[model samples]
Target: MKAIVIGAGMGGASAGIALRNFGWQTEIYEAVAQVKPVGAAISIWPNGVKCLNFLGLQRQIKAIGGDMASMAYQDYQSGQILTRFPLRPLVDRVGEFPYPTARAELQSMLLDEFGRGRVFLNKRLIQLEDNGSQVTAGFADGSTATGDLLIGADGTHSMVRRHVLGHDVKRRYAGYVNWNGLVEIDEAIAPANQWTTFVGQGKRVSLMPVAGRRFYYFFDVPLPTGLKQSRDTSRKDLKRYFTGWCAPVQRLIEQLDPMATNRVEIHDIEPFSTLVRGRVALLGDAAHSTTPDIGQGGCAAMEDAVVLSLSLRAHSLGVEDALRRYQESRVERVTSLVLKARKRCDVTHGKDPLATRQWYHSLEHETGEHILNGMAETILGGPL
Candidate 1:
């Protein structure tokens, strides 16, 4: 089957890889002039890594940043430990691999696997029309292309969703914003694989090492939905927000600097019900956009690609059977994650000081394997 995949991001590239693996001819289109890692660091859970392994990209997975320490947890304001989960014991229990890596590494590896000249740059999809036995994608360049099957991996604000869902689906603001930035891996940081979280009034921060020399931190703060801050805001402003927290946070802000090339992320996100409509399939943030509270945003997108590919490969070419089945397999899992992430955001940013965060942190260790294993069973149960 000739397949046209839109939006050359993680979900789109992954769908292309899966279709190619199934011996289908695939064409990928990206709205961007060039596709690159647009986010900071990303952590791939064990279930998502299983999909990468199925695609034979385990080496790239291993080459990622630091792994979680055997023990991970959240803390209270009283300096008391709350929840602790042993992550090392759950690698295979979860599935295969679960690691946090730089965003560029994952994007670059997928681009390499796609080979050169495969991704058509600057071809923004304008609309899609079903032509009985075939689907046609209309592009802004006034050129049109047809394929036996079309998959829309356009993220968050997907154009494909507007085309297929018949009307515009608005993103629901979860009433908070995320503050994400990276700092040099402090030479003073003694914990090699440790990751930690601290929750305070109306704000929460989670920190982990993305690479040997750099650590990534994202703070979700309860804010007005439509509030906008200057991209040129002084780092001192961010410093003010994070002041008097953990030593690691203070040190991180002291060393971190934002430049034109790097952005200190501050944006709002909401959850979507489902990303698929008719023959057009939505993947990643396009379908389910959850807050980054649980750090499952990117990982959920990676899993979406894997599941969509498997569903298509299991049925006849250009058939709606597979698409319907894809929706069934994904809706519950993706929606569940979306809700879970939002709940985390709410709790983390609540006004309980660090009490709630610490209580959950203590539970993290006990539930780590169970959570990872549950994700594996949910997403990997069907065909790869």
Candidate 2:
């Protein structure tokens, strides 16, 4: 069987690897001149790590990934710790470690595993035609490629998804903007193994460790969609937004080189009722784009790759049947996550300030065991 995958993000690369593992010839088309990960960092929960294990890349992932020892949620203004939780027990409960990794490094690893020669860069998808038994992909470069199956792993602005779903799906803004960058680790900002976040009044500052003694830091502010910030003004604007946040947050912002920062307005798609159409199917953000509030966006994409491969194998590559089963198996889980993440985003951004306060107050009394168990349940519930 031959499979053509669009977009060379985690989903596309992982889909290629998973399909090839099942003895299918696979090719990936990426619109970029060179495949580079968009974001700064991704927190790979146990569920996502499970996908890597299936692809036999766990060891490589661990090498490039930073393990979190703990997390501290603090009051944004007073800098008081609302809750401190250990992460080790959760790791033991799930039987796999969660990793905070640099997105580019993880992408490079996946591309290597999938075989770089099989990925065609700069091939922006124009259209896809399913001719009963085969699917043909038309590229903007005036090239055409055909395969037994086509997987659209393109992200939020997915062209393949537009073609397969036969409609223009717009990205729904999540009522916020984010500024992120990488900087040398500063234990003064947060412990090396701690994922520290300061939150209040619809804004947050987080500093999380990645590999190589570096930290990926971000500022999230509830703002109107389409708000733009120039580099000269971004630093000053961020400082103004996060005024009186905390000493560490202020210091971190001061250290940022505006040129190196990435600014984005977060958006998610409404969950698709269907993920497959004949010989073509959508994967990752293409199928179900969700807000990154819970850090499950990329993780969901990784799971999609594995689940699609398993479904294909289960149906013995009976194309349409496999695709149908894949959709049936994934829709509920991914949809639930999309809704859950949206809720998290709302709550985190002060949709109900009173409720957020109550939760923070409640966290003071919650035991580490309780917190760990709740998290473990979510991570362990993922596909085996």
Candidate 3:
């Protein structure tokens, strides 16, 4: 069998690798003239790690990933640690420690594994056609590819998703602006192996370890959508928004290179009832885009890749049947996650002031185990 994978991102590349493992020929089409990582870093939780292991990229992921051993939540202004917890218990329970990896390194590893020749650049998908037995993709560059199945991994603003639903699905703004980038690891800011976060006033500043003695950091402010943001004024903007934040946050803003930081207005789509139509199926953010509140966005994408491959392997019925099986298996799980993340986003960002204050109070009184158990619930629910 043959498959056409759209978008050469985390989901698309993993789908290509997984399908190939099952003896299917696959080609990945990317929209950009040159491939680049969209963000600074990503958290691959235990479930995501298990999917990578299944794809035979465990060694590569570990090589390019961070050693995250603990987590901490602190008051944004005072820098007082509200709670601190060792992640060892969660790691032991899930059988894998979550790795915070540089986006560039992780993308490079997946592309290398998928093989450069199998991935075509500058092929923006303009249209798709499915005629029961075979599916075809039309590119903006006036090129076309036909295969037995099509997997749309094109991200939140996905064209492929539009074709499947026969309508444009509006993306919901998560009511925040985010600035993220890489900075040299400094213990004065946080521990070398801890994921530290500071929260207050509907805002957040976080730093997590990544490879090569560096920290992947991000700042979140609950701002109105469509607010003007300029790269030239990024540092100034962050400084203004985080004026009363802790010393570590100030240091982060001062130390970061504005030119290198990525500013994103966060958005997510409501979960769809179906992710498949005939031989075409959606994967990753293309299937279910969610806010990063719970940190499972990429992990869910990896899960999709594995489940799609498994459905194909198990169902000898046909391409459409296999796609339907994949959809049925994923819709509930991904919907729950998307809704959960949305709720978490509201709580953390002060959309629900009562919930946000309650969460802070809970954190202060929390033992390490409660936090770890919550994470474990998400990690253990994976199809792996």
Candidate 4:
């Protein structure tokens, strides 16, 4: 059997690797001429790590990922620590520590595992045809590929999704703007082994350790969608929004190169009722895009890869049966996560002002155990 994988991202590459492990031929396609990861860094939680392990990339993941030992929440203005807790317990319970990695490193590792030669670049998918037994994908370059199955790992603006659903999916703006980039690791900004965040006034500044002795940092502020700002003015705009914030935040704004920072108006799609139609299945942001509030966007994609592969391996009825089983198993879980992340986004970004204030107060009295427990619930709920 053969599979046509679209997007060549974390989801597509992993799906290719997984399917190949089960004796299937795979061709991965990418729209861009050169593969560049969309973001600077990503948090691959324990569940995502397990999926990578199943795909035989454990060594590569550990090599490119950061060592995160603890997490802290602090006041945005006063810089007082609201809660500090070790992550060791969560790792112990989940059987693996979350890997905070540079997006480029992770993408490179996945592509290497999937075999660079198997991935075709500059092949934007403009059409998909699922004729029961075989699926064909037509590219803008006037080339076409046919396979027994098609996996749409294309992202939030996925064309494959429209084909499967027979309509376009609307993306919802998350009512915030985000700026993220990398900086040299500095203890004065945040501890080397800690994920530290400062929150207040429906805004957030965070720094988390990634590999290479650097910190992956991001700032989030509640703002209107489609508000225009240039890269040249990102630093000035950040300073204005974060004025009178903590010393670390000020330092971050001052030290960060605005030209290098990526500013985004975050958006996510409503969870779909189905992710499959016949031999075509959707994965990653193509299926259930969600706000970054919970850091599960990529992890969920990894899970989809693993589960889809497993479904294929476990079912003997037929390809369609296996795909249906995969859809049935994932819909509820991904739907719940999409809703949960959206709720968290709303609360954190002041969509519910009272709830946001209550969240800050709750953090003050939190002892880390509750937070770990909640994380454990999400991590353990994986198909692994």
Per-candidate TM-scores read: 0.87, 0.97, 0.99, 0.99
Q: In model 1, how large is the Cα lDDT of residue 82? A: 48
Higher-lDDT candidate among 1 and 2?
2
| Residue lDDT tens for model 2, 234-265 | 78989899888888888899888888888989
Give the per-residue lDDT of model 3 (tens digit) for 1-384. Answer: 999999999999999999999999999999998999989999999999999999999899999889998899999989999999889989899899799999999999999999999999999998899988889999998999999999999999888888889899999999999899999998888999999999999889999999999999999999998877878889999999999889988988989989999999999998888799888999999999999889999999999999999999999888898889999999999999999899889988999888899999998998888878878998888998
- For candidate 2, the 10 contiguous residues with the lowest summed lDDT are 373-382
Show the colliding residue pairs in model 2: none
The regions of model 3 sitting more than 4 angstroms off are none
How many angstroms is residue 60 displaced in model 4 relative to the true structure, after the best TM-score fit? 1.0
- Superposition-based RMSD of candidate 1 using all C-alpha atoms, in angstroms: 3.3
Superposed Cα deviation of residue 111, candidate 4 (Å): 0.1
In candidate 1, which residue ranges exceed 4 Å CA deviation?
74-85, 187-190, 260-275, 351-384
For candidate 1, give the lDDT of residue 139. Answer: 93
What's the lDDT for residue 54 in model 3?
A: 99
User: Candidate 2: lDDT over CA atoms?
Assistant: 0.87
On TM-score, the stronger of 1 and 3 is 3
Model 4: per-residue Cα lDDT over 1-384, one tens digit each: 999999999999999999999999999999999999887899999999999999998898999999999999999998999999999999999999899999999999999988999999999998889888999999999999999999999999999899889999889999999999999998988899999999999999998899999999999999887777978999989989999999999999989888889998999898888799999999999999998888999999999999999999999999999999999999998998899899889998999899999999999999998889988998998988
